[model samples]
Target: MSARARRWPLVLLLGGTLLLSGCGLFGGDEEEDPPAELLKFKPSLQLRKAWSARVGDGSEHLRLGLSPATDGTLVYAAAHDGRVAAFEAGSGKRRWAAKTRLPLSGGPATDGELVVAGSSNGEVIALRAADGKRRWVGRVSSEVLAAPAIGGGLVLVRGVDGKLTALRQDDGSEAWFVQQSVPRLSVRGTGAPVIAGNVVLAGFDNGKVAAYEMSDGTLLWETLLTPPRGRTEVDRLVDINATIRVVGEDVYVVGYHGSVALLALESGQVLWARELSSYNEFALDFLNIYVSTETSEVVALSRRNGREAWRIATLLNRDVSGPAAWKNSVVVGDFEGYLHWFNAANGELQARMRAGSKRIALAPLVVGELLVAQSEDGKLYAFSERGKR
Candidate 1:
């Protein structure tokens, strides 16, 4: 294989820093340049406090993935201590609460009528949205660390053991299951499966992209994202964060500790690859791919060719979360409890707010006119860009 082909697995897991290894001690730290002035566009996005409420008693040191889910009117979320709550999206008032004994390590995903969530102990639970009552509970062998993907009347889930299973949406029945080999050293898995057309796509630490048929669970195609490092770098197994996205025929995937690449889904061909020296997930806003680095730098790249569009350095170091797009604005939350909104056309600071809380991973979801975020400290905050208009 050529050098680019051999570097595929490493790039998928650790970015370009896979060669240096161990928290990227000897990696490159080049600063990114801001985009041209023509790309500058103002973002009228801001966070507005609607309502706030404490649901279940969450545990400390449990980096549980319990992000709030919304249906434009009500927000549904799972708690660290195994509690599911429904809230009024606008007021943040509690509507109903359903308690489960399993610690919810995964976030909640909704399918119009039913809300689904996973546990650290290989359990999948479904609840009625209106009453917050238990509908069904499905169990698997491995623990679930990622959120389930709901679409086409089915729920697609990827577990920590590198197992992908499709569950029935109505009663949590097992529709199909497929297992793949796990990497020797893997990060805490957090990538959710994304459905594109007739296939379900997921990222695994083994450095491969597996696509399965949505209806019968038949293996459609499995493409190795990269090759293993030779004996010279055996400890460097491919590790990914599970943020796989598909736009039309192109699939964009990035994992922790590796590089990011754009692949043609039709033939599993790598169109372009770039050394992104970081492990942050990417947000696609129909135009550009927005990514954040662990060293607190934000960058925007062209989706077609992996070319740098813009870059900016922030004060954040360890809390550099990824970016999300809303309207004409791109928003990101950092470990310092601050939410920053930038212009999507260009990399310019637009608005920011100190959301208050640090020991949490912050992610902003721009739904309709509401910018909803889940603080690492276990709080759901809402904001709006009304004043910017």
Candidate 2:
């Protein structure tokens, strides 16, 4: 089989096993249970649409890492077909749009002046944020599946080959590079690096998280979030593909088929860990950390002790995005393009909205008070609290 043909099963498996595992051809004698119906609920809070726009053809068959990046005033987004656009955060008016004519698989990272994205051909294109002018293009070792991070005058990108490369922000020149051991069989996606103070934190397919010095690419510390277990390779597959979260002095991360762990930022010490499996980003407030599990359940746990607060499993098998906290509510998007809101204090359904007819592949971007979501069909919608300005 060609490489393209070989990738299809991996993509389907990462999306969810229900697509193939439940079939009678797989040798199960008993019939699988049907998915639960979505329950009807009364509206507890109101949400109003602020503005809407489009980028280009969004992720169709490929799981694109296209997400919106903001600089307080303008929101930047990208499509898989190499179209990157910027819009005013308040009005949703298009500021500028640019096309690289390449198949983009990752990015839309910006640090106010420069916006950088990665193409499937291993090229990183940088554009000016003011008018969408091309600035520079740099090459990497392989495909980049995560958004690049900018800090300490460097743009940090993590590739699917388990390599992290840092490029200078002004000229796209190579600053430093680091490589980690790549597992032979792992998930299809990568976690974008998070920059805090003078360090950059990233996760690997080997179920490890490492911190690097931002200025020189020095390895500060590495910790195994989940040690591989079981007998078979599939049974021992544990990848830390979820983005790491930094809150004050603590760092939080999750691994597939493994655990959610809280580590001390200063020494990479495990303070607490809870058995969980997730490949999505997480949100945090003062009291709890909100997460969307691999089985499509939304859960909240105490940040202080890693104790479970509440979990809502009504959206199982829907391929839900990670939770994003807004006001007193937590929001999550599903494959059917529906955005569900739950009260943060308790897991009560408060409101729901449909962004488009296609699936919502990424979490909603919270811009101040506005909630911005991008659907698979290339539609972008900005919403706000009903009564507020």
lDDT of 2 by residue, 1-389 (tens): 22222112132242233322223222345443344467898999998989989988867546667778898899998887888999999999999999888778787888898989987778899999999999999888877877899878888999877899998988889999999988766766788989999999999988999999998989999999889998766567688877899988899998888988899998899999999988777898888999988777899999998999999998876777778998899999877678999999998999999888776766788899899988877778899988865
Model 1, CA-based lDDT:
0.70
Model 2 Cα displacement at 74 (Å)? 0.8
Steric collisions counted per model = 16, 0
Would you list the clashing residue pairs of candidate 2? none
Tens digits of per-residue lDDT for model 1 on 1-389? 12221111222133222222222422325333322122243545544565556666654334456677777778887777788888887667788988888778786888658888899888999888898889899976666766788888788888877888998887788988887887645554557888998888888877777778899878777777666664534345565664688999999987554667898877667788776644445689777888876455778888888888888865335345567787777777764566778888887788877666653353566666777777655666777765531
How high is each candidate's TM-score? 0.83, 0.92
Best-fitting candidate, measured by TM-score? 2
Error (Å) of candidate 1 at residue 173 is: 2.5
Residue 340 lDDT (model 2): 93
Q: How far out, in Å, is residue 360 in model 1?
A: 4.1
Candidate 2 accuracy as lDDT = 0.82
